[model samples]
Target: MKVVIAGGHGKIAMLLHPILEEKGHTVKGLIRKEEQADDLRKAGAEPVVVDLEKEDDISEYVGEADAVVFAAGAGPGSGKERKWSVDRDGATKLMEAAKKNDIERYVMISAMGLETPRGDDVFQVYQQAKLQADKALRNSGLNYVIIKPGRLTNDEGTGKVKIAEKLDRGEIPREDVARVIAEILEDDTIEDVEFDLLSGDDEIKVALQEFV
Candidate 1:
């Protein structure tokens, strides 16, 4: 399988590259900065430089890939406008690209507990943007899996997780999230479903069994 990740240089995406490579899949990461290419290369992924916020049509960048992952985001410090551009619009553009390129599998790295918008104005907008993007993917009529993970941490991955249609607010390591994404990409049985993820007792494969 060939996989394209929109935020190639992101923390979770960087972790995911090597895992996908080890699974015998080709990986390409879409990066906004040219300098990020080396980092992606070291992680075993080819880097394609394309600014998601600026590109109206990114289908060419997406090219021929078996799957595309929407992992790009406006940083937490950015304003509400960027939230719409990078988070909502960027993700939607990827969905369009996937459809244009005939890519049936799209995996979205969304957030959990977005149904109730909270936080400051900017944060609320961010949540709203994510919610909109998730809705778009769900209605896009593609084989999609939206993994809504809780607060992300940098802790080491334990390879155990809890997945369900709705999970209590919690947190999980970025590494574990990447592991789950990798597993989902390989498991064709998991499609058109969204789930909340957190660190728990079940192994990665076992936790995903219910979705299969």
Candidate 2:
């Protein structure tokens, strides 16, 4: 499959690139800077410079891929104000691009507990931004899998993941989340279920397959 990854150089993308490539999938990394293109290339993915925060004609790039992944983010360097720009507006831009390109299968890495509209916690600001993005995707009339994880860590991949259809709790490793993203890309069995993952003793594949 030809996969277009927005934010392909992110922590999640670090693990995703190898998993997808190992499965023989072609990847396109949508980056914001021309310099980031080199890193994407080294990861075995073709890079395209696109600022997902801005509105533009994405028909060209989105139309070229079979699937799209919104892995792009504003990053920690981007101040708190960027929460809206990158997480909400940026994500919306990418999805709009996908819609224009006629790409239906989209996998998004979202945040946990953004379903509500009220929260003032500083960290929860990210959730506010993600909430807007998630709402847009839900109303986009497209097939999307929104993976919302608790806290992220640099722990090694345990190959075990816990998944619940309406996961009301838990945290997971970014690596395992990356692995799940790969699985969602390949499997058509996963319908329109929102997933919240966490690191546990259960087998990763099995836990994920449960949702299928």
Candidate 3:
């Protein structure tokens, strides 16, 4: 299967690229900065420079992809307005592009506690932006997997994973989260379902069995 990642430079995407490529699936990364392209290419994913906020310019790429993954996010260094633009509006635009291209399978990586974004919260803007994008994917009538991961860390991968359908607040490894997304691409049982994810020491397939 061919998979197109919207944010190839992201932490989860970094983990996913190698795993997907090793599994023999063609991978393409939608990137913004030209510098990211070299990194993505080195990771074995074809990189396409396309800003998420202006996806109309790259509708052709979205149309050709067999599956789409929304793994991009505005970095911590970016301002609040940029979060809204890249996380909220940018995600919505990608979903629109998916619709226009008739792409049915989509996976969106979101935050664990995104439903509420208190003004004083340090990540309030990010929460709001993610909530909007996540909600859109939930309502989008496609084979979608919305994986909301908890506080991300740079810890080395443990491969253990968990899947909760409702809201969850478990800490998950970025690598573990990436594995879940890639596993879903191969598993058909979780079709049209959304799950909250966290790090564990067990295989994601075994962890998600009940939900499936």
Candidate 4:
């Protein structure tokens, strides 16, 4: 599979690149800065420089790919505007690009517990933006999978996870989340579904098999 990931320089995405490469899939990462190219290259992904915030039409940047993953975010420190732009608009743009390019598979990295707004004003906006983006993907005619994980941490992955339609508020390592995304990308049987993820006792494949 030829996979393109938005927010290529992100921690989770950087971890995902080498895993996909080892699985014999071509990986391309979309980055905003030319300086980030070397980092992506070292991580086993080709870097395509395009600012998601500034680009109006990003179809060309998306190009031809078997699948696309929306992993971009405006960050916790960013204000409300960037939340809408990068998290919501950027994802929709990729959806449009996917439709235009005839790519059927799209995977979204969303957050768990976004149904009800919470947190401070900016965070509430972030939740709203992410929820809106997930809804757009659901409505989109393309084959899509939305993986909504709980709070993310930098701890080492356990290679085990629990997945369900709705999971209680919990946390998972960024590495494990990347592992789940990689698994979903490779498994064509998993589609048109959304789930919450967290660290657990079940092996990654076993947990995913339950969904299948």
lDDT of 4: 0.95
**Model 3: CA > 4 A from native:** 55-57, 118-122
CA-only RMSD, every prediction: 0.7, 2.2, 1.9, 0.6
Cα-based TM-score, every candidate: 0.99, 0.90, 0.91, 0.99
Better of 1 and 2 by lDDT: 1
Candidate 3 vs 4: which has more lDDT: 4
Tens-digit per-residue lDDT, 36-151, candidate 1: 99999999999999999999999999999999998889978999999999999999999999999999999999999998878899999999999999999999998999999999
As for candidate 3, its clashing pairs are 160-200, 172-199
What is candidate 2's CA lDDT for residue 190? Answer: 71
Clashes of 1: 0
Supply the TM-score for candidate 4.
0.99
Per-residue alpha-carbon lDDT of model 3 for 22-57, expressed as tens digits?
999999988888888888988989988888866544
Q: What's the residue-level lDDT of 157 in candidate 4?
A: 99
Q: What is the C-alpha local distance difference test score of each model?
A: 0.95, 0.78, 0.80, 0.95
- How many clashes (backbone N, Cα, C below 3 Å) per candidate? 0, 3, 2, 0
- Residue 199 lDDT (model 4): 96
